[model samples]
Target: MPSRRQVLALLAALPAVLGLPEEARAAEPDVTAGPDWDATDIAVLKGVLAAVYGPNSDRCDAVEALTASFAWLDGERKALVRMLPSLFDQASRVLVPTISAFHDLDPVQQQACVDDWAASPLAFRRQIFGALRQLLLAHAYADPATWPDIDYPGPWLGRYELPIHPLRFGDPELP
Candidate 1:
């Protein structure tokens, strides 16, 4: 009969004897699950935009900024949403608030943001799209997904998808 000490030692060494090596067991890398933006995040964004652009900026600027912001956020959200599409069905949760918050503004107040922006269509588009690209890049780096099928549309598909989708104003590839 094996003593308790011998039994315990054998149990500990059983894995090696069975050919299951310790090296085979490794922990998975940590990936953040999803966007955790809350109301405070919205407030922070609003405050930041207001501060950088100034309080008196009009609706056109606000909407244009928002359009650009959404384009960028779409890239970020799409990256995550594609990874766990079923889990992150509520990707619009982050964006909807931005629209609603702007919608809540009275007409005059909204226009103020618009008037403050550059009149050149190209400049406006550039600023908006640039901001969005940066935002999405930041999001992708933070929550990378290993799955390939979860990728966002490439340039070709991106153009096709944006205009048809209500969330996008126009194609990012456009001049």
Candidate 2:
């Protein structure tokens, strides 16, 4: 059922996706996750943030941003996040039987857990990982505190009032 082009495209990406030394495209996978978590759950969240965002990610108040983002989600999503930790055990491919609590795991273990879920063989696990990551990332990018590091000056709209000199919303004809 494979088309030649699709097959070829996958074949082309295979070498790079294989973790080859020279392949830079897959050198780093963009992994992100956000959760609608409880106060008690946040202790582990900070560790996950440090692991997923790397050592220098503490400048932004990610905890607050994540908390706010979590607050905005509905009941179903909130429940999923509450349960995300338990799902971690199902994501790992390694034979490191009897995984510890996420908070108890070292930083390296946390990162591995995220990576495993993101790239899990089970589609649902990957889907949840994708959803969690996207949720966090969307909120983080929207937070003004995160802008300085990325060098984004706040939105231009705030600084500029475009002149509607020739036309207004009502008039369709050109001025």
Candidate 3:
């Protein structure tokens, strides 16, 4: 039979093996998420701006593509956070105007607009790109997976039933 000391020693070593205590681990060199913003995930916002309004502007298409590509990332960030209400507000503002503008254009004109925007000089693309980066950065920090299940936004498709038996409550008397 193993001695008590041996068991205790093994148990002590178990944490090391499993990496149970995160703080005890040796520090790793911090790496930025990407080239665009800054050390604190701000760069993600910057990258979005760069892709959009930079010298080769693709602000219209790039914003849409970036948002679409990061659909999963959106879930990671969740919809409403208190601290970033202003930032979210800003994004909402841009999205509203841009979405309105996009819809207003005829289909062919919209396509041409996007194509033209994509081909624009890099400088102009930066305008809307930063907001995109902010979105991605927020998602990483917020970790939307931890959010609780919420009812669907607009409405429920079907009726909800209470668990009580029908007999528990007598049917309404005929008028």
Candidate 4:
């Protein structure tokens, strides 16, 4: 076994080596939760957003987008989503032992936590990271404010007014 000094050195390097930040939380990042999401879920979602995007990403209306996102889900899926916060917390306990939830950690720490999961050895964890990332992109990018960042000039509704092609999937009379 390693000596005490070696263990302390390891602990100091834990954040970078393990992707769990050791810095104190400077401030709480602002994020809006939908009516369907409880505070805990919202917190976890905020942590995810900070990790995927920058910590200061506050332009997009997360609440509105998530509300619509959840509306399309079936009851079973919604229940599963509702339980994700606790699940994330339980899994992340090793990283931030003092914190009750993943979001309780500082943004830097939260990002570290997300990074850990994204690169986790477990396939399940990697899948969870992908799902969270895709979910954020789905809703966050839907907001017009984020369109410029991704060079997405919103949807093309003018397709109805002017046909880009003679044969379209939605158009009738296609053989």
* C-alpha lDDT values of all predictions: 0.39, 0.63, 0.39, 0.69
2 against 3, candidate with superior TM-score:
2
- Give the lowest summed-lDDT range of ten residues in model 4: 24-33
TM-score of 2: 0.57
Q: Which candidate tops lDDT?
A: 4
lDDT of 4 by residue, 16-59 (tens): 67654666222322133333666777778877876787745678
Candidate 3 residue 80 Cα shift, in angstroms, is: 13
Candidate 2 colliding pairs, count: 4
Give per-residue CA lDDT, model 3, range 1-175, as digits (tens): 8899999988778857896654553343223221222232333233333333333332224333333444333332433221232342243334433443432444444344444444446553433333444554443324323222322233233456546566655678844
lDDT of 4: 0.69
Better of 2 and 4 by lDDT: 4
Ranking by lDDT: 4, 2, 1, 3
Q: What TM-score does structure 3 among the candidates reach?
A: 0.21
lDDT of 1 by residue, 13-50 (tens): 87688776645523322233334445543443343344
Candidate 1 has a TM-score of: 0.20
